[model samples]
Target: MGEPLTIHLPDPESAIHLAGPGEENLKLLSKQTGASLVLRGQDLLVSGPEGAVNLCRRLIEALAYLWGQGRSVTSVDILTARHALDTNRTEEFQALQQDVLARTRKGEVIRAKTFRQRQYVQAVRNHDLTFCIGPAGTGKTFLAAVLAVQALQANQYERLILTRPAVEAGERLGFLPGDLQQKVDPYLRPLYDALHELMDPEKIPALMERGVIEVAPLAYMRGRTLSNAFIILDEAQNTTPPQMKMVLTRLGFKSRMVVTGDVTQTDLPEHQASGLSVAQKILHGVEGIAFCQLGRADVVRHPLVQRIVTAYEGHE
Candidate 1:
């Protein structure tokens, strides 16, 4: 609506080859900044409002710098540039950044205000395997499910596999009625809810039937190799150490795994090591493995939920 904004880059013969797919980068930047961007020669033409235009220019410069430095520029970087261009104070933008990071293709960004949600997303994008440890309401399971949905939508993986331990938090699963899925459905419902948000409910059953999406008990993962899949292990604290080893070993080439759990909420009996906890200790310093510990400050739920988590922490 305002004056057109243009950005000119000096022709550096040495950096010309560094452009490497400039059109794609321009498209990505335009999407993030909500500004139409076109490149002619060494000039970038962005026509938008004064503020948005200037912001786009800054973002383009930043992207060129990052690319020139050989740093990977991900979607996160695009969002970060948008945040920096829009806001003067970083604290508010940081909160917004967390929301942007919590975004998934299946649904909108997480509404809850928690930094842990952002860290969880970052871990998933940056690592081959991510361990998200936190208390309830931290959006651990929900965020993981969202990432799985995004991976599927982007065709980054062939399928989505969601697994959780069958162990009841306190009750007995035997007391529940019906078959195995019926018995475990209560535990797996959260995952289904996430999927429904990202995809049409009608499509879910078809995908499940076709094995494009699978919801199963952790025990069923034994003796199988999972390749080209976005695998998520939820409520991992209920798994025993041997079970954890078996599950981790099942990762086939080109598969990414995310394990989410609350260490403080472990239901495992005393003297038995929780697989999540054990993995945290054993996998530390291991290359290609990432760990993200979410604290009470990262809880992105009702205000009361944060207070409740803090009260529990006080008792500990």
Candidate 2:
């Protein structure tokens, strides 16, 4: 092992932010870089093999932009910082650190927290149609919803349309209680949850009534030309090939579409195929389209979620 290296944080506040609550962020740094870290006051001492120590130092430097801004460090930030270092995209990573996509109703700022997520957001901004396929908790649908709402509030689009295939609601929808909406509401709860995070719950119904925002099952999307709107199709992995084709063809003038799904969690029957998978194969090199694939490293939920995804991937 080489001599220990000591880095001084700007202040106690910066030190705390970098260390994270319960020193979890420090633990993550050691785990990731194979270094030993001990924070004493404002000094962070790292000791290990020369290569590991140097890498740990570089990772910390890459994350300086965030902690320098007094922002709290998170697992996502650490993962993205390492990714930026690995890919030599530290300059782009610094740019992304300053871009806030939107703020939540609770006043939390929302931004891309991983390398692939930033790419996905940029893809959505630059392309008319973008598809993001990843495992759960990677912020695929949530980030799309955020961008769609931002476009709507800015008057970039006249309406916002959210749709997904209600896989179990095909023929059994009529047998359920209430009206068509009530029957489909269960299938659309996740989309509603995302909307509620950005919009006030009481105001959402009014928006729906005025047609400013529409949420419906994929079956209701047939025979319609959607224009002047931002459209999102979530849970797309459950859609059949024909259903996917119908929705893709519905895109009209002055509109944008985001398709998000977890291909591994498809609810389709064993004999059926996932439209998301088919579309990826068919439209990969097509112009005016973008496809982003996120992996376990992109998950921004609880840190344990990343481990769970890795475990499942290994089993598969």
Please give the distance, in angstroms, between residue 114's alpha carbon in candidate 1 and its true position after superposition: 4.3
Task: Give candidate 1's whole-model lDDT.
Answer: 0.75
Report the lDDT tens digits of candidate 1 across residue range 253-272: 89999999998988788988
Error of 2 at 120 (Å): 1.0
Q: Model 1: how far is 217 from its true place, Å?
A: 0.6
TM-score of each prediction: 0.67, 0.93
- Each model's C-alpha lDDT? 0.75, 0.93
- Listed per model in order, the count of residue pairs whose N, CA or C atoms clash below 3 Å is 1, 0
Candidate 2, residues 228-300, lDDT tens digits: the string is 9999999999999999999999999999999999999998999999999999999999999999999998999
| RMSD (CA, angstroms), candidate 1 | 12.2
Give the clashing residue pairs of candidate 1, or none. 106-198
Give the 10-residue window scoring lowest on summed lDDT in candidate 2: 167-176
Question: Which portions of model 2 miss their true places by more than 4 Å?
Answer: 169-171
**Model 1 per-residue lDDT at 197:** 74
